[model samples]
Target chain A: MLHEPASQSGPDPASEFKTRLGVWMFLLYCLVYAGFVVINLVSPTTMELTVLWGMNLAVVYGMGLIIFAVILAIVYDFACRRRESALADTPAKGGKQ
Target chain B: MAITAFLIFVAFVLGLSFYLGQRTRTSSGYYAAGGQIHWVVNGVAFAGDYLSAASFLGICGMIAVAGYDGFLYSIGFLAGWIVALFVVAEPMRRLGKYTFTDAVDAKFDSRGIKLAAAISTLIVSIFYLIPQMVGAGVLVEPLLGIPHHWGVIMVGAIVITIVATAGMTSTTWVQFIKGSMLIVFSSILVAAICYRGFTTEPDQGGRVPVHEYATLAATEADSRLTVAEPGWEVVETHEDAAAKAAFAKLARDGRQTWWLISRTDDGVALKETEAVVVAANGTTLINGAPPSAENALRQVGNIEQLRGETDVKSGSISPIELLAGLSDKDTVVKRWKKASFTDADGGKATVYYPTLTRGNVLMRPGLKFKVQGTVLERLDFVSLMLALFLGTAALPHILIRYYTVPSPAAARKSTIVAIIAIGFFYVLTLFMGLGAMINAVINPADSNMAAPLLARSFNSLLFAIISAIAFSTVLGTVAGLIVAASGAVAHDFCDRYLRIPMDDRQKIRAGKLAAFSVGTLAIILGIAFKGMNVSFLVGLAFAVAASANLPAMMMLLFWKRTTAKGIAASIITGVVLSVGLICFSPMMYGQFGLDPTTAPIPFNNPGIVSIPLSFIVLVLVSLSTKNRNSGVAQPA
Candidate 1:
């Protein structure tokens, strides 16, 4: 088979850590999202129940999913930036030079 | 007024494109804005690029008509961005140069991968583009008082110029401007809606009159009735046959008249409602008269009763109060259901009949998604949600935006900004939709005009501004898609896969040519698919993207055993299976003018079946082709 060097840039010292962090967050979100789909599937009437602030589960959950994503994204960004900075400062420790 | 606003908006977008065009001399500059855009600007532009006509017009219209079912789309669409941010954003930025294909083929350098990825990119972009173009047409018809096709052509020509001239630089700035305007304007409209609150008689006190259906009392023995106003002369009424059978016959006969038999306090009553009829000889009538200034189809959508309020208007309220009022049990919203039929005189008629739904029901899921429906129906809802959640990360236009940013961190940060902006915009959609629902401004024949029409209900100036923003929404998204498609054609298909030798100048030229070609193709498809629900088409595009691109991207990034053949095979499988299933699905069957029930696939969405199958195919193919995986990039 013909071989070619990878066209992407050299890997960042924080790449592995970022991937791990991203995957975990993604899976965490997946579970909550799945819960939403399951509730809708099993008993749609549950959505009509007034849950919080006079809004039903449908509005609450739907809006919650959107809001939660924003929160998760902000947290993820802060964590990644902090880790990347840490790795940059001590390249010989827990990361490749 | 709307036309002038629309013209001014278009001119500003074009002028911006020309100003940016001067800097785009090199291939990289044209394709990725020299990879120097500010992360904040890129982020809002990302929202602009992502929020197509489907997100703005389709979702609002869906919410306006189906209540909470429309908000489900907003949730699903926003959730998909989570996938983009957490999974694809940084890696895509780190790997690719310009297009999504560049990122996927970074390790393999295989012609097969290029072919598959480019083809998938083009197909997905075209599918995504059609709805935006159609939405442009839909907007222009009401706003500019022009033919739908003319609007499609104008948008196509303008977007082609925008993309062909400045490429990514122009597209990104256009998106950023549009994204900002959309958020600001939508916020204003939502605030206005909250200020107006709930009103049982929204049309009273000099507002546009709501269309009212005519109801007449009838004895059980009455066999024939004559209606004078709506041109139904000597209408034959039946007592023994079921209502469904009578309606079915009327539907089959092309009759424009819709009659409903209901039990009132004073015996049985026959109701004749709003209809638009077109005779075989080409004459048109709305409510039995020619469609003149005074005889046009009136706007519909109003609250029949407000909970706990005998007063006609609730004056002003908070956003929470608005939601509370809509979900109240005693509040009844008057929504419409449409049907079409041919009459005995060879005239075609479409009618909209009212269904008074409780406020609580209107604020829940059963209106459109039918979560409580049959198993297949529920599956359809599940599949749609799955597609929306997975599709955002996989969409080629969105993926390409990652490359426009400088570093992987910039990609990540910008994506967060996009999520916040997009999420906030979607939340506003709920209020705008509910406001339109009770404001008596929905165009019954076309729900896609709901948001703009709702803006018009407040005043003409808001309407013009909202409509203009909507038109720019289409332009921004179409420019992004065309740029993505053109990149695939020029960089992936022609230069790499076909082994066509070209300099940077030639490559940019080829990309411009591809942009024009794709723009033309989008115009044709947009005009051809006129009147199809914009959101449904976007959902199908999402399904295809999720099925064809997501599995390959996920496996390649994480799974070490993934081979070039596997990626290529999975892409082909994803595209073919999703597109094939869509063709045989019930929705397409109905589009083909066949009985929807006779479709082989009972459900309309293809994501549930196709997405998993693509992943399985990728794994199986990768496992078998492990020996050929020689110099593949290790999982990051």
Candidate 2:
């Protein structure tokens, strides 16, 4: 089977790499997400607003997730592309394969 | 009147369903509509299905009532889409067959994987569907003046028929229509808020305070009313001097009088009975009677001002200003409280306290539990964080959507479109929520009425259109969810597990049947959980998806050491534990004590413990059997 060698491998990805990435990124997201959340815990800005539930804000709540998802997707796409192109030229890398 | 319009819409939806059902000839047509949806159209349909009545109505209502907190939910929800687009879209398309299970099973050929993934998809979709059904029930009742049960049933039959007929094609079109219309009408309502501008003045019919009251009887029971306001909060007035005098004599002689009003049946406004000041020692009387002035505490204050208000345009008020007057106790908010007293027979007599405002925390929890005061605290926050980080990537519907496209490029484009539409919609929700809060014409009784009511403030025609679109929005989403569940059943369980060597046509036909069954089930659940908040239900759905599916999917893709046994074990444990915990939690109970009948679990959500447990189970199982399946895997 056609596969790439290990020259381009990044730090020989550990079992915990994705898990750690998931954790840290999620932490940062929570911090940023708090801005909108704080408003709900406090108050709605409009003097004549429609309704409010605590920590539930309007500005790009779900869309914020979609955007982040898109960004990650782009990154994933690039990484996968690199790996696939590399694998196509070299043989199966010795380690995981 | 509303019924006629709703019925006509229902008929139109049904006719479309029948037309599409007849046209679904191929398995591709039934499952993924032969991978032919335009990115833009699919994106709009995504919006239609995702928005739902809770979003159109309840969220707006919540913001109008609760203020800033309501808008916060909107932000979280929109942000979650980012997780979906960038994380789950394109890669999922490249990997899976007809179902998310296809991706998992392709790697290991494990029956265990198929079973676990199928169950997880089914459970999450079912929980998510309940809220939609409930939303349908809420809307149908008001529009048709029919009870909530019929509303659920109606939505059910229509959705089942739609999915059973045209399959993904009809679902996509329905969603596309619903999504586009919801956004357009919502935009119109936002414009109206701008056109109307902010008015700090009281209503012409005597501005309804955020709270009001009428005495019912000698028993005290208070019912709180939700009011939308831009610059004022109403405090009920109980300044009837004549009635006070009349009741004063009877109250002193231990007699109680009754009054009448809407909603509360136990309200009794106690009058001029001499106030006895009991000292700290329980019964030592300091003053035998109330003060000479009319401004006694027991003598309900009539002249609570439209106080603490400024004339800033309601549209311009920042999130902070929306709830500014909420904390001002002198403004007198309305609520339900019980009055217990002794009777002539030496038995206790009770009355409903109507629109009585004594200071209580506006966002305070009714009872203290681990979860009661802690959603914003560390653990619950962690749970949500985990879900937000992973749920989008793992959602079955999202995974399958990727495969609908021919190439990864189409998936990428669709993801981009979804992001753009979703992002714009989130921005609009901010204005819409704030608009609902300030729209004096909005219904004060239901916070869920915020979006539609905001439209009504512009014009009833706008209101009718917005409401109709919102109903369709539910249909779009329900259709999508049913499609996902049916895929799991038809492709993963029957085709894979049962070893049924069916052709594409039979597979598609079976999927249609499965969609029909699941759709009906969702409708029944929707009716069962009526009146509960839709946002909360959505959160629960996210939690389960994140907890149950994310670990297994991620591990399989990212961890080279992952084993089929591990993936299977993790999915199994995650789904069961989360579902079990949710079912027994205090969120199911009305009280703090351990009540099995009331609680589904010990808390509201199980993400805190269950999520971690899933990861650990996966690791342990993988270690035991990691190398055994090395040669058995298929190429992606």
Candidate 3:
């Protein structure tokens, strides 16, 4: 319950939350892969059959969302790095060295 | 031709194994084949090892009868390899000594991690080995004309011999050979299908009545032979006028087809006694005395042969037609002995199609989860998934595959190859399955008959080749699993636990003996669990991998707060929790004749729950004790 948001360095617990959520993704994959075959043993259909049972909708959407989220996180990380790099490269003119 | 081909194939396989055994003298050679397998050989071996009979025969059988559902296993199995390639292969190669545990505990000096890992490796491997043994037993019964138990024993003995003599060196080359042969023969079978087309009957459906089990054992037999009596039961499926009309149109279109066989049962008393079909029209005479008409029944002869060249030219309509209305009882489809199993009440239940319904009652969940709506049900799914995601990185057999090559790069390359090969194979499963569905040749009585039956529809030569290759693939996979299990027990646990001081050479020697012991045990278990569904057992292996070993590996890689104690706790926790959930779930209980509801868990799968618990435990423990090994725990 105490796990939430994205906490890395600050007084935030979000970082812990992200890791726990990642475990959820892993479980979803397990269920879909294992459960799908057992289901196939019973229902003999095309759409349900051709498209792998657990893999069909969930994996595609889940992966797609994750990719987009990753891209946004990357962009934010990049901008922050750029600002820090510029700050480091700036001339020391008025500081009390 | 059959005996000659069989001898040649056996000679070739055995000879190849001997060559590999010669190279397996060194510890490195025995354990990881001196890390010198060519990627191409390993690549195909990977395919060969990965494509068990469960994949070849099981999936094909599923596809042939169950429509699309059968190919579903192929897809799921292959997709797992994709994860192995992209995410795990190279990273796993960089970690561990003998088992997956070695990798996780690399950062921590913890006995708990060692024990937990050793146990996981043992559990997954033994479970995995059972299926291979079961498949072997099944194949041998038909080929060698032995009992199922005998067949299982033969496989066990053969596998142990191979593993004991050569270690990983022999194991890898065996896998390499088995892998190559399986694919090559499978391709040949596919070609035969394309060239000769399909058959209504192998031996032209002219099995001049072999004394198989079913014909004689109207009474239950004391043995499990590959063959049973043949009699097609009829399944009456509902078809509305509209649907019937559509079917009629489809038939009229010439593309829609039907085939039939005229079967006459010479009711042999459960031995090899003969009774002939008599003319039912009327009794003519008998030795100058009036004979009873009751003794005569009309036997239908093949008229299609005289009716047209088309019937003569027809290649493969028989298998499909035979399966179409096999259970209506009204449709007197001709077949050989249909399989029947006796229940505990001694009620002789013919296992053949009294009904083929895909209802939940038939597909009831295994003992794997909390109740469907309960909190544990949700937790179980979560645990199973966690284990799967993490397990790939932790499987000892999978991990050692990385060491079969020179570097992490090669491991990465091998993974890519595995993904592609596995992916293509999965796709082929769909076609193989769909083809089986329409195929009339596949025996519905035996799900294991799917692939071989499909090949039989084409030609005998192909059937022989595919069956042999399928057998070899079992050998290869079993060998790999045994190697993994043996290494964990010998190198990690024994070397660590007993504190046995051994030179590198001695260590390797001990490992070989361990391999021998495990191989023997596998044979025994395989024979015992022969009746259990292998795919399900494999799923259990996957669950254990995902939960017990995965958490520790992940914590080691990313968590700066990790300590030896945390790693140990998580691994032990993951293994116990995941396994407990699975055993107590409805799936296991139903399988073992225990009350499903009596178990506290709901969903039969535990990966969704146990895997996460592992990671959580590892994280919590690590954070709490991070100060103890802040510098030491950092990745070297």
Best by the lDDT measure: 1
- What lDDT tens digits, residue by residue, belong to model 2 across residues B1-636? 345555667688778878877878877777777777777676676666666555666666665455434544555556666555544454455556667777776666778888888988888888778888888887778777789999899888888888888888888888777777777777776766665544544231233342333232233225332222232222222223222211111222332332222333433433222223333344422123323453222211121222334443234433433333333333333322233333233433233333333112332211111222445343454455456545555667666666555555456566666656655665577668655544454443345656765665556677677778778877888888899999888877898877788997888878978987888778767766777767667767877887888777666655677888888899889888877776666555532334544553434657777878998999898888867766233322
lDDT of 2 at B99: 76
Supply every candidate's count of residue pairs whose N, Cα or C atoms clash at under 3 angstroms: 6, 113, 70
In candidate 1, stretches whose alpha carbon ends up further than 4 angstroms from where it belongs are A1-10, B210-212, B222-234, B237-257, B263-267, B308-311, B631-633
* lDDT for each candidate structure: 0.85, 0.59, 0.55
- Which ten contiguous residues of candidate 2 chain B have the minimum total lDDT? B363-372
Q: Candidate 3 lDDT, tens digit per residue, B65-177? A: 54433543554455455445534554556654445765666656567667877888898788778877888887767666789888787766677677777776677777777
Sort the candidates on DockQ, descending order.
Answer: 1, 2, 3
Model 1 lDDT tens row, B1-636: 988998998899899999999879988888888888889999999999999999899989888899999999899999999999889988878778888888888888888889999999999999999999999999888777889999999999999999998999999999999999999999999999888777777873357764566665554445444433343444443332311323211221344445656555766655666778788999998876688888776778888887856456778899988997788778788887776667667778676767789977888788888788999999999999899999999999999888787788888999999999999999999998888888878888888888998888888899999999999999999999999999989978988889789999998999999999999999999999998878878888899999999998998899988888899999999999999999999889877788788999999999999999999998998888888777465674
Model 1: pairs clashing at backbone N, Cα or C within 3 Å: B253-B342, B254-B341, B254-B342, B254-B343, B255-B342, B255-B343
Candidate 2 stretches with Cα past 4 Å from truth are A1-31, A34-97, B1-8, B200-307, B310-378, B440-446, B530-533, B591-602, B630-636
Which docking class does model 2 fall in? incorrect
Question: Please, what is the TM-score per model?
Answer: 0.95, 0.71, 0.67
The global Cα lDDT (0 to 1) of model 3 is: 0.55
Worst 10 residues of 3 chain B by lDDT: B242-251
lDDT accuracy of residue B593 in candidate 1: 83
